[model samples]
Target: MVENRARGNTANAARPGSDAGVLVVGLGRFGASLAATLDELGRDVLAVERDPDLIQTWSGRLPLVEADATNADALVQLGAKDFPIAVVGVGTSLEASVLITANLVDLGTPLIWAKAISAEHGRILQRIGAHHVVYPEHDAGARVAHLVSGRMLDFIELEDGFTIVKMRPPQETHGFTVGESHIRKKYGVTVIGVKPPGQPFEYATESTRIDAEDTLILSGDTVLLEKFARRP
Candidate 1:
């Protein structure tokens, strides 16, 4: 049985091909978080979940329906085809995840983001037409590892091995202009910005001096970024 508990203005619902709204399938941790964030951002979101308990828990908080996303008929009933973007956050059961993703693909959801537990799972999702595959656990673990291993304040890994990090300026860079320190030439990393204590962040330039007390925002290949952050 499909139970819709969506609240809000139906007139404001996004039309097909519009980027104004998103359909999230599954109310697992990832899906719930994503939906909440989107809602906070003021985007129209409709969440579909199979579990009645999960639906009840999120009721009045999110516009959602109680329906198994693996069933294409249920999705059709929910106007899934009209949604420009969809996220498949069912990662617990690989079969269910695949089925839900496949159903979304068949419904012509223009953009599909799916969660995968492993490389094999990710590959399958991509092969089946998931526009984006996220490995939340793997990514969180890597981010935490980077933070604990060095003096890094934060780390963000982007596609193609590129990475960005926030860390204190190395002792070698103290009191020297960016060009004089030769950080990019020596460490193969570019200091993109700097944030001093109680001061607004500013873009880094060749003439911008690095202070040991200031935080540096650097970008480079993952390996080089890690090596540079390890500097004492």
Candidate 2:
């Protein structure tokens, strides 16, 4: 948490404007990373932090403002109302997070993304006008568990309980045609595509052959996908 202090540039001087500009509130891990990455992508970024020390430290690398983001007046003075998107990066402090988010909402910020500490926090953030609520810790934990299980080569979580996984075709399914394998019937997963070790990707179809060395792209319910992953 940034202590209340004014140190870095806080002037509302003429600022640059582009469709790529991003407003990041809070100089914590998520906010800092997002700001840096966006800057690397050639986008203009305005990062805010209450801590004078943090503002001083990071200002050399990017545009930063030292202010209490929970203060609506401060946000307005910082010219946050014009930002196309604002990300509230303080997830641990529910009060600070909510206040900052609400301030952005009231400022008519078009898109607000908030980090949430829990399910309840996520719900509240969404209800309070957060366009997107991210649970980084929970999602990272799920990814780690999948990696440790060694069933999937990669995983991408989609909306709700669905997921996309890349894995070698199970031994039992090798040499069988996609339709013959009956994966959807047995595992409740769909094989969207496949690729050989050194070959280009090909769409999976009823006649596509499933080889042991073929990497399959499957998508379905998270539970069912994990079940399939454990098979081979």
* TM-score of every prediction relative to native: 0.89, 0.80
Q: What clash pairs does model 2 have? A: none
Alpha-carbon local distance difference test for all models:
0.86, 0.83
- Report clash pairs, candidate 1: none
Task: Give one digit per residue, the lDDT tens place, for model 1 in 32-67.
Answer: 999999898888899999898999999999999999
What does the lDDT come to for candidate 2? 0.83
Candidate 1 Cα deviation (angstroms), residue 116: 0.4
Error of 2 at 215 (Å): 2.1
Q: At residue 133, what lDDT does model 2 achieve? A: 81
Reference-based lDDT, residue 73, model 1: 96
At residue 186, candidate 1 shows an lDDT of 96
lDDT of 2 by residue, 76-145 (tens): 9999987878889998799999999999989977667788879888888877877778887788888878
